[model samples]
Target: MNPPTSTWWTWLAVAALGTFHGINPAMGWLFAVALGLYRHSRRVVLLSLIPIALGHALAAGSMLIAGLSLGLVIDHSWLNRICGTLLLSWAAWHALRGHRMRPRVGMQTGFVGLAIWSFAMAASHGAGLMLIPALMPICSALPGAGGAAGAAGPTALIAAIALCVHSAAMLLTTGVISLAVFDRFGVSGLRTKWLNFDLLWTGTLAACGLVQLAL
Candidate 1:
């Protein structure tokens, strides 16, 4: 189904957000590498991507549910401003603290650990925050947008598609990067890169957040 006419802008925003997420240093391929190191098994390393993708999907799905339940409308510029402000605040905090973030890969390296780590990583970084506001206008503008609880079928479908597309892109991009790093530098090099770039990634997030606020 086509997105509501009035929500085109929202869709574009969400798509852009997805692209941004793909490029974000903090959320990039590094986590995959960390998982590889933790497991010390190439098979497990490859499998870890599954949980990370699922976790991201869950976070985005949760946001979509919240928007639908609240009858959230994104027509208001003020709400965008509020979201922007929040992002900026988060960025400033990271900047001030220099973001001593570390990958907490456990020894167990089981599915449970992978899932928990994936969820924690996504939530901590506000993975789906951009998608929420971006889809709000589209969902609210659809026909029978708020007519009944079940009226959100079309919008929900669109959201599912969007989330899938975004998550797939993330997995592919991250997976490739992880494999490349493992092939070239080995686990030691990957770990060293993660350690060195932690602050840089934090700064990048903070900068993006602030820029969103200003825009």
Candidate 2:
């Protein structure tokens, strides 16, 4: 089925989120670069993107399931309010003490390990949770597209598209950055940045939450 003309903004949000996640080193790109350098092969870095995206997808899909479930049962207005509140709460928690929430990273994890790590890290960081409001707007817009066996088609399609777009963006960025770091200046290049990624992430979280609340 074709996407509604009115849904362009929704699609843009999905893609934008992907690009945003791609830019985040914690999303796995930095690790991929490290893995590449450790093995002295770019192939390793490229392959690492697979499980990284998979784990990210699984993490995001979990929230998609939750959003879909809620969309099917609750009124859009109420659902929005709930999501708004949740986002705000998460933002505050993250901003106040995001460091303490980081999942323990494994030092010896391989491909599968990387996938699991990505999933755990993304989930713990509320990456999926951040997408709820964006998805809810589109998913809830569909009338009768919830709860019923036949009702999920449109929402499912959108969610699937979002997953693909996000994964692709993350993979592309990971590949590019990993390669650049591998060939150019290595990890030291990343250190040139003065801004703290965590603080930036915290601010982003808060901004997204505020937008959700305003919506």
Candidate with maximal TM-score: 2
Off by over 4 Å in 2: 145-150
Alpha-carbon RMSD, each predicted model? 4.2, 1.9
For residues 1-215, write the lDDT of model 2, one tens digit per residue: 85455867877787788778888888888888877777888898888899989999899888877866777766667766777777677767877777786665554578888999899878867787777767776675675755645557777777788778777877787778777878887787656764577777777777777777677
Candidate 2 weakest ten by summed lDDT: 142-151
The CA lDDT at 98 in model 1 is 33
TM-scores of all candidate predictions against the true structure? 0.71, 0.91
Q: What pairs collide in candidate 1?
A: none
Model 1 lowest lDDT segment of ten:
67-76
Q: lDDT scores for all predictions?
A: 0.61, 0.76
